[model samples]
Target: MIMDIIKQGGRARTTGRPRDACPYPADSRERRAWFEGYDGSAWELSTRVPHPSVALRGVSACPDAATVSNQAAAAT
Candidate 1:
């Protein structure tokens, strides 16, 4: 998966697609052709901190699914 985080109007928006379907591989001639055709800044590879939307809820950071299931069953 290749995620693209774009900065627009003071907020961050993300878009992505599977890497295998892309025509622009890093070392390929197709990548150079793609850049030449676009007017925007060149795409870059980067890592980002987790987005707030992905924050954990009602569970630990690394919860075990089986343990959570058992606990929920006990509560009912």
Candidate 2:
């Protein structure tokens, strides 16, 4: 979605992450989107904001039912 592109790009720019460090596959539209925000003001933002990462994102998608059950069983 457009919002996702904006978000990733913004993060890339703010974090001063290299263009090659895009999480999306090579030659993909998402990578292009990421590059959008990663222009011009990268170092400025990077000085004020941390780089992007899953841990820094703070939230995560839920696992599937089977995976959850497996984890629960393993715990018990």
Assess each prediction's global lDDT (C-alpha) against the native: 0.40, 0.61
Clash pairs detected, candidate 1: none
Candidate 1: worst-modelled 10 consecutive residues by lDDT: 1-10
- Displacement of residue 10 (Cα, Å) in model 2 is 1.5
Clashing pairs in 2: none
Best model number under lDDT: 2
Off by over 4 Å in 1: 1-22, 40-76
On TM-score, the leading prediction is 2
Writing each residue's lDDT as its tens digit, candidate 1 over 3-23 gives 232222112122343324335
Per residue, candidate 2 scores C-alpha lDDT tens digits across 10-36 of 776667777677687877766666665
RMSD of 1: 10.5
